[model samples]
Target: MTFEDTWKPKIDAYRAKLDEEVGPYKALVEGIDYSSENFNAVEALDTLLTEKDREITNSTAKQLVAKQRDGTLTAVEIYNAFAKRGAIAHIFTNCAMELFFQEGLERAKELDKYREDHNGELVGPFHGLPISLKELMKYGGKVTTAGFVCYLDNYISNSPREESVSIQILRKLGAVFYMRTAQPQSVMHLDTDNAITGRTSNPFNRKISPGGSSGGESAAVAMGSSVFGIGSDIGGSIRVPAAFCGLYGIRPTTKRVSGLGSLSGGAGQESIFSSQGPLTRTIDDLEYYMVNYINMGKPWEYDPNTIPLEWKTGVSLPETVTYGILLTDTLVEPSDAIKRGLAYVQDKLRDYKGKKVDVKVITIDHDLMKEAFKQTLQIYGTSKPVHDKLFAISNEPLLPLTKFFLGFANPEENDILTNNNIKEQFKYYMYYLFKDQGIDFLISPTNPNVGEVPKNLTHWNYSSMFNLIDFPNIIFRTGLTFDPKVDVKGPTNVTDYNANDYVNAPINLQLTALRFEDEKLVEGVKLLDKALELA
Candidate 1:
């Protein structure tokens, strides 16, 4: 049989599974045409939600939790609202790889029953929250396809004990998982596309990408189908998608949160470690999830790789906050929209009415960052042998993006040691810059562009730099959107990002801190959000 004959059946089966899981909810958006040009799925989807659904889905996780605690909203009611919106989001954007609506609702019902039986005591901090997960996270008895067609039948454990450690913690905290989001093939591409579930579109503008490998999560969160979503990041996975979707997300210091049970390539590779965090609509909600997930969950006790550090509370930024704003990585310059967004932020910081804040234009060490970028590509390729085996198992054809990614893999692991040594040197250089300049935090572009056409995202230098140096970074929207009429192209030699193609895409910026300064980083972003009046 031909390649399509072999793989097409698996794709069909995977999609069939999603439909079967979605069940009756499919009728809500059955007749809508999703092929229209430049469709605003996020806006269109909002109208379909009932007033109650809108209220539930629009509220942040913290708000929903507060209502649940006060007995104003039951777990089942919240789940029902999100379930309807999430189903519509999936139909519109293809954001969901798997659906567990029945299971999630049942769990929500149980939480409500428990509350009724116990006089309104919440089961956990995140009681009754509907969370979307990236496809790789194990959810018990579900297939954990890490975007590879070959692993379509690899079902996870059927017991709660076998769920991903992070999932287990979230479950204990009363999170209901109803949807699994999409990722790119090989789980390496910065754009979301794969053979099984296809590409996830940007809800803001269907013409462009939602960003990946957490693209589905970003799309879901942006569509208001989810209050927030969980995503993993190694090289711009979480931050890029969050930026592309105009949401907030973070990549915490490695091992601060457990990644156990999240399957992806590079099982034991430590040259560049992956970290997982939330994608939320508000910075306060982002902090809420982190503080509760780490402080209350205590993931280190469950996942051996997690650090023993508790999520710090009462952490505050320095008296006179110093922000080193990086205009470009000197590798790929940011687009006009991003430049405008940076200028807006700089102006806001300069005009802050609060405590002392200083904004200084800083230049990055291009040679050093370029070398580190190359090292990251090589390190990523070391998992080629393992990925090759997965592809071979089912004779699955490589997607275009996966082929492009594998092309950068080293022939062997010989250079891994050298790659790691260079990483250490780069980290030291960055740390010195922080100390020497007394920089409290660093601000930079989240991507070269606001959003790229699907399967066309390039230049990850802005986001991947943090992954290389193992720093914690948070991505937040600037309350600005790309206006092609105003965000005109510059000299054209500096960037290849065409603003005309990214109309209505939100422009976001990155806030980064030294390694293990996650608490302080969150605090700093909170302050920056206040300065900029981000709601």
Candidate 2:
């Protein structure tokens, strides 16, 4: 009577047939040495971050290009170091789905030759930056199965004659994506767990889950695998992993970037929301990407769906800015670390900046926001129980966690209409949230728990609530993470918002703006990003 009861046998047969042919791949995967890989990977990483931080942070891409012009370092050497680290990262975290190292090296060599020919001068700003990609993105001649069981043999990515639009744009800006990272089955989970590459682990701790479907990108960037990475989001796909892995990421407004030609599991589901953005080490790197990925790529030219808006670099903040502080959404009270982390951030913004920053605490109608967000994620919403049941069929072991999703009834007995109505409420709540707060942006925790145990999933409503509002939100670490002893404190709420279920996690802070007011949100986060020194 369960979802798997009818389809498990069919899906398992398909997986067996595919595995039968991919003998060596299946064999190589069985015995991976994670500890050795993680240890060596982290040791090598410290040096690269140190070098890149000094070179890129001060004057940024503009300065790096200037330094290249002055002959300090060649593009080839930078590309080589990052590529090697990225390879090690794949082994350490199960972060890679496919690779093109040789291809990227060859391109790097060409850039070296170009600089040599001109005595140093070259192309665009990000001429030598190393970037990795999520598997859902298509690059010509790379498989784009995107973790589906049936499409394991799909060669859409291997069609050399056709490259994805994003790939073309990156190449034009002199960016090279030498590898593709992993994703989950439906491309919906906040953690990676698919049939092909399996689940990816957190870079900080291998036992913990990195938020997904963009988890691999966040993990890679966190472990110093790549300088920056591009990932897609719908819900908190970009922010969750960024928060979970302790990195900076932006989920730009849905229409800001190109999602065209990208491989996705649920292609047509857009009512809730979907977007593509960056998971990077530094907020400045994020700016570099947004500026170049917009101005130079000319995404509007390729995808009609993309808004014909260009990056407005000249936009300036007022002499002072006030942030609408949303300490807790009141949906689920954040863990002690989250509360402390936000307080720390609020304090730093006051003392560190010293002057010229105006801050305010704005309480939002939490009951409405929480109720609205909860309604949006019901059984038959964008993430329908039926589709979940279908995807779960491919589950040979039922994923343990998903069994709870099937509910305690036969598939035929589940309520469908009641579910969709809740999903619709998410849209209704957004209309009220912005009207309630006339401030610049809302700040709140991404998850009540920093990083959860592997299969013990609980929170998503924090950011999912914002997703309901269709706000442009981003996540980055404050360099402070979970230390349960220091972070733990008694519950604040006398009722349901009690402290018993909470535990410290690297708290994620969300900066949100009104619909299409992404520029304002980005500016506000950049200030906090600088103050927090998350880079």
Candidate 3:
């Protein structure tokens, strides 16, 4: 059969399966208007819930777990609330690739039974917490699409069902997974879109991107669909979306979280490896997932690439902290909104300096960032062959973003030697730069601009440089947005992509620490988060 003929049935079957899965929840959404242009997922879901249900769905994973353990809320109630809300989020944003609310509800019931049988004992750290999975993570018996139409029929495992190590950890911790979020076709773009699931719009403003390939996760969490969700990043997949969606996300140093059993078009090309981390509305939830995933999950035992490091809790920063402010990376100057957000934080830090926190700012040249951005593209180019093969199988036309990425490196070049040399040299430069400055962490714009309109995202240097150097980075919302009246175009244009008014788009900043300093990065972010009143 022709590839198109073979792929057509698979696509139809996948849609049919989604229809069947969502069938049980149809009645729950009967009163809701899915087609309303005025529909806001967060507002609609909040209105749908009782005051008590709203409180349960809006609580952080840590808060939910505590309530469940104390018998204040049942597992079934928590799961149902999130599941129904998740359905609403999907309706508004097209964020879900798969929905298994019935299965998730059953799992919640089992957890409740365990709690009752054991005198209100909990299953694990994440007991009764409703979490969403990125499309890349493998869930047993579920189709692992990875946003590729070619893999629509590819069930997670053929024999004894297997889940990704991260998913297994979450399941053991009593995380009920009702939905798998969407991603871009190649899982490489900054916005989520694919042949199977279409485009996932920003929940904040439908015109802009939610940020991908983890866009779905950010949108869902931002819309209160899930308390927390897993998102993977090679470039700015996790951080950009988190920033754009007014949420918190971390891109830990590579391999900190297990990638085993996860699907990626860039699989096996480790010039720059992807890392998995949590996307949440609050900073504490980000820490909650990291601490438990490291200490309780024991990732190293399952994934060979994971480093065997215990998660350090109670991380305390010094009384005085130094922050290196990077206004621009040289490749692209940030938009006025982002610049204003940076200045706002800097002003706040200066005000609080020497009293409760010691704050210092060091501005560094962006020559290294320019080189790192170029080299990171070369590293990403190594995965073209893998992507080419996948696309060839389904005879699918390449998306614009895919075409742009594939043109980054010469296919004939031996990427291993060249990319590694570039990485090493960049690392050396950063080591001395941080040493000379004696800064705790470097802060910059997470993206050159706020969230982009779909298909217009091009410059990734702001976040990709850290990926090139393998530093631990986090993106936190600045609690600011673009004011069209105030933020107008400056005389010098810094970006080549089309610029928009960016009305109501969230502005966020990136913070980074040295490699293997993931714990310090989180602690530093918390301090800055407080100073900026980000919570």
Q: Each candidate: what lDDT?
A: 0.85, 0.66, 0.81
User: Which wins on lDDT, candidate 2 or candidate 3?
Assistant: 3
True-vs-predicted CA distance for residue 505, candidate 1, Å: 0.4
Tell me the tens digit of each residue's lDDT in model 1 across 1-535: 4447776887897799887876787677766778875778887787677889888877877789889889889999999998888888888888998988889889999999988898889888889988889989987877898888878778898675667998899989888888999998889888898888887888888888899889999999888777779999988999999999999999999999899888887797788899999998888889889999999999988987898888889897778999999998888776788899999999999999887999988887888888888888888778888888878877776777788777776666448778998889889999998989889899999888787775456567789878988999999778999998888773233345455677788999999999999999988888888888973
Candidate 1's error at 244, in angstroms? 0.1
Tens-digit lDDT track of model 2 for 153-254: 456644423556777788778776677788776676777777555678776666567887788898788766566788988768888888888777888877
Candidate 1 colliding pairs, count: 1
Residue 383 displacement (Å), model 3:
1.1
TM-score of 1: 0.96
TM-score against native, each model? 0.96, 0.81, 0.94
Please write out the lDDT profile of model 3 over residues 1-535, one tens digit for every residue: 4656788777777778777776765676677665543244565566666787688877878789888888888999898788877877887788889988878989999999999999988989988888899988988877898988778777876332367888888888788888899999999998888888678888767778899889999999998888788999999999999988888899999988987888988888878889899999888899989999899989998887799998887777766688888887766667777889889888887886434554466655577566567778888988888888888889876778878877887667646787788788888888788888778888888877787776667888778888887899998877787777767752123434333436667888889999888899988888787777764
Q: Which model scores highest in lDDT?
A: 1
Instruction: List per-candidate RMSD values in Å.
Output: 2.0, 6.0, 2.5
**lDDT of residue 500 for candidate 3:** 49
The TM-score-based order of candidates, best leading, equals 1, 3, 2
Residue pairs clashing in model 3 are 190-212
